[model samples]
Target chain A: MWQKLYTWLDERLGLGDMYANLLDRPEPKGNWWNTLGSASLFLFILQGATGIFLTVYYTPSPDHAYDSITYIMNDVAFGWLIRGIHHWGASLMVLVVFIHMVRVFVTASYKYPRELTWLIGVGLLLLTLGMGFTGYLLPWHQMAYWATTVGTQIAGSVPFLGEFILKALRGGPDLSALTLQRFFSAHIWMLPALLAGLIGVHLYLIIRHGESHFPDEED
Target chain B: MSGSHLSRRDFMKAATGAVGGVITAALGIPVIGFLIAPALREDKAGAPIAVGKLEDIPVGKFHPFSFTITKVNGWERTASNYGGFILRNSEAPDDILILSSRCTHLSCTVNWNESANAFLCPCHDAKFGPEGQVLDGPPPEPLGHFEYSVDDQGVLTIVPVELKSEA
Candidate 1:
């Protein structure tokens, strides 16, 4: 009965073809190092889940923002564990993504047909850091406030457009309620949207080129 | 013989399904609780805050005053600063108006500009009149007010919640 149901659904969904193309494809023998890409993907999914859970209790306003997070950590059931996973997941994702890049570089996987993949990977790395930067301020704590103040100030010191960039990032002369609001928007919406889109393209490119074989003495 | 009937491929498939189910439950159950806990809890309101002595505030002029509400949630304690303008309309204890200094546009603190006779928000250049009416700038509405009561000793106390004011 189950087999019949699966066959019927598979015929409509092209499930067999999808499984063959997406999962059962050929690849060069991979070592433990090859697991980093999937590991990063896992961490990204975990972070996304935990972050969504956090937003249920998190407030963007300066008034209740810190207290709200404190409530999450102290009162909410399993909130600490979820937040802990997300907090540590972010650091681990960055490390894993960077090491994945290094592994690709060492293997010269960015050569030729896979250059676009490398480029998208670089974009993903940047968006990940952008996520970190924007998420840091949501708590509205003193540390997050001052760090962002210095961070945006550095951006404002650019050559000619420094002032504009500073104002654009800060939404004004200095970090205020608007800064916190905008950062919340970017962290949860804008950057994640871009990252998700870029990740789709990155994964497609990897599938297209297949995992590049580890380079040997071959020219 | 009986054990040999469980082929390696079948055994692997069953193992994978079990592992996948375990992983899903491991993260899913706690996460659901985490997301729903806040909704299940009761909302706590701030206690009545005493701003200052009503006798000290001059009549017909807005005086700046601030108060801090410290909240202890879980293991952390945070003190949030809130300020407003107090206008003692007359010698009558009940005849007074208190307006929050928070700019309606973006919650930036507005300052009383004695020269301009208006509360000016530094962040967006918003201005408010003596009655907390929006005078100029991006503020969507007038400054908010607080519910207050004056005791026999002329001590003015206000509920910290910002109430919307018409006009």
Candidate 2:
């Protein structure tokens, strides 16, 4: 019954061909280090999934934000574990992406034909940092508030467009409900959209160029 | 497509999917439950909190009062500090008003200015009069008023009210 169904779908959609192309690609001889890229991608997906769950119960207002988080931690079943994974996963994603970049750089894989892939990877890194910064303030706790104050102040110091940038980022002279709403939108919508687009390009380039061959022993 | 003949790859593929589905269900059920549990829980109501004695606030002046209220969210209980002002109106001695210190514009804590004779918001310079009415600056409306009652002993009790945003 399953074979019949698979044959019918494959005839119409070419699923078998696509699956073979995706899984049976050729690759360089390398050690465990090659897995870091896949690991980073996995972590990114995990973050997106967990973030959706958090948004279900998170109230973005200052009055209820902290309390909502407290409820998530204490009241929801497995809330602590899910939130913990998301919180720790964010830091882990950043760290793994950084290491992956370093690996690419050390192997000189960013040179020549692979330069566009390297550039797209850089874009992904910036988006990841943007996600972290915007997400840091959703809880509306004291630490989140003060840290955002300092962070925005730093942005307020830029040369020509500093003041405008600060106001745009915060929605006013101070961090208020507008700031919370803006950050939440950026964290969940804008940054994710940008990251997904860049990941698509990055993956396309990876497949097009093939994984950079491990450095030859003689060279 | 003979039922009696199963290739090793086909057998492995079926086995892999079956095991993966089982493992996914084992993990996914608890996570889905956790995500939905908060929405299913009953809403916890806030109770009236005792601020202090009525006499502590002098006549014709606004005095700041603070108290901690235990808020229950789901299974977690948290004590959050709530602030308000007690005013003994000299014009209407019978009318005592308790106003929340949060500003109407941005919800920043408003402090009473003795020299200026108004409540000032440090964030955006919004000002409110002693009776909690908007005096000047960027505040869209008057300060919020909390529901309160005084006991026979003159102990003032205030209930925290969630302010409805005008904007």
Candidate 3:
């Protein structure tokens, strides 16, 4: 009976050689800027994991947001640790990504064939910063609120489309509860999804074009 | 330094440095993060912050000190403000009074009226005497005082208390 089940499961799920082929762990080698890419990936996963745990307890409403965070910090199991990881992981993610950009730029990896990937990479970095800034405001504390207010106000400064930009960001004239909901959606769903899609395409391009040349190179 | 003679030592040293730069860039961020993450983050729910010098905070003068805590205090991210007072009262003998900046009437902050010797709340013209007593106008009570102390260094420290009436 067990043999039959194993055969049936293998036939259906097809586990044979899947991990070996799909995750062959490529030479573990790339240019100097290479490891930063992996570090960014690691931080992203950490953020996602911790963020999910936080979401379970976080309340997006103005009425309960502060209370929710307090509860998470003071009462929830290992809440502070989880919050710590999320906060630190987010910052680390951005830092690593920014360094990745710097390495690419300084090394002239943006030249020629990799320009599209570089642009997408630049876009991804901006998006990461955008995500962190918006997420920073979600807690609705004094600093978060005022800082975000300052930021959105800056966005409101853009010529011609400033009003439209603010409206799109806040979903109205002011930073109301709707703004919180909007930002929350953007942080957790919209921006993250966009980031994932962009990163996928970015990596695909990288694979297609091959890694850029290091500072000292054959080519 | 002959052009054709690249010694094994030189090649190894250069290779080590190149690899070292990459690895350092890669691991440097996480290490700094792990070490400094606590300071970069705020408690959001109100972290306990300590402010300075009870003796040095000359009467009628306020001072500024900042500590890291979460800025996400509400669902809307309100900026937290903390205030301290150094007063020489015959009865209390150089006691410290730390207060929330919120006005009693509608929660706007009350500016210290050094010239008038009071906390002046503009929202409703509420005035709090030096002792935080209700002096005049629409405010029903004093500005909220905080949990405070003079450390071994005689530096004043205070707990952040919510202003406005409990109601």
Candidate 4:
């Protein structure tokens, strides 16, 4: 009976073809370095899951942001673990993505038909940093506040368009409640959407090109 | 003759692309404005704030005074605390200097260390002299100052805008 059910679904879904195409096919003999890409993807998903859990208790406002996080840490069940994963996961994802990029570069995997993959990977790295930048202000603590002030000021130092860029970033001339609100919006919605979409394209390109062989000294 | 090669399928594709572009612009333009409206709006300056009575302040000492500025940012109103050290140069009403407590480095609050005779920032160990001059550390400029006025009733009112001191 189970065999009949499996066969019926497989016929309609082309499960056999999918298994052969997606999971079975492969190229280069990968070592530990190859695992970093998957590890980065895993961390991204982990961050998304834990971030969703956090939003249930996290209030994005100057008045309540700090208190809400306090409640999450102190009052809610397993909230510490969830937030802890998210907090540490962000750093881990950045590190993993960076190392993965380095490995690809060193192995010369970005050459030939895989150049587009490198371009998309660069976008992913930037988006990851954007996520970190926007996420840093969500806690609304002193360190976050002052750090962001300096960070935005650094952005404001662009030769000509500096003032406009600074205003666009902070939503005003100063770091007020608007800054916090906008940063929270970008952190949870805008940057993540771009990251996820680019990650999808990155993965598709990876599968299309197949993993490059570990480069040898030969021409 | 030019129109003869245009097929109905081609027309359909063009029509679909036009519709999609129109739909995108209809939603996109307003969304962009909504996100960026605050940046385009003029920043409102704070009102002149009264810190304290001028008679009570001592000469040759840094008088720490704090005031709250209620600013409406987006949908919320936030009351932010701002403070500065008022140095009365002498008993003369016009002989006064006010330095913002915010360190020039990263806006961290600075303290008037009487023993050191300078303002010390706890965040980066930046130091400023009595006249708000940058003495040591990473602050690119001196501590800012506020514009002020002494009323007939001897009330000290400050404009609250931080004027950057030239390095």
Report the poorest 10 consecutive residues by lDDT, candidate 1 chain B: B158-167
Residue pair clashes in candidate 1:
none
Displacement of residue A42 (Cα, Å) in model 2 is 0.4
DockQ of each: 0.34, 0.35, 0.03, 0.01
Error of 4 at B161 (Å): 54
- Over all chains combined, what TM-score does candidate 3 have? 0.52
TM-score leader: 1
Query: Between 2 and 3, whose TM-score is larger?
Result: 2
lDDT of all the models against the reference? 0.86, 0.84, 0.72, 0.85
Give the TM-scores of the predictions, in the order they appear.
0.66, 0.64, 0.52, 0.56
Model 4 C-alpha lDDT per residue in residues A1-219, reported as the tens digit of each score: 999999999999999999778655676898999889888987888788778767867888898899878776765556567788789889989999999999999998999999999999999999999999899999999999999999999999999999999999999999989999999999999999999999999988988888899878783
For model 1, residues A1-219, the per-residue Cα lDDT tens digits are: 999999999999999999889876798998989889988887888888888888877889888889888887888999888888888888888899999989989888899998899999999999999998898888889899999999999999999999999999999998999999999999999998898899889989888888888887875
TM-scores for chain A over all candidates: 0.97, 0.97, 0.85, 0.97
Order the candidates by lDDT, highest first. 1, 4, 2, 3
The better candidate by DockQ, 2 or 3, is: 2
Tell me the deviation in Å of residue A86 in model 2. 0.8
lDDT of 4 by residue, B1-167 (tens): 78698898678678978976995575345444433544565555667888999989999889999988776544347777889999998999999999999998998999999899889999999999999999999999998888899999999999877521211
Pairwise TM-score winner, candidates 1 and 4: 1
Q: Regarding lDDT, does 1 or 2 come out ahead? A: 1
Off by over 4 Å in 3: A1-32, A215-219, B1-167
lDDT of each residue in B24-121, candidate 1, tens digit only: 89899998888777457554567788888876889888888998767654435767788888888888888889999889999899989989988899
Give i-RMS (Å) per prediction.
Answer: 3.3, 2.6, 9.4, 13.6
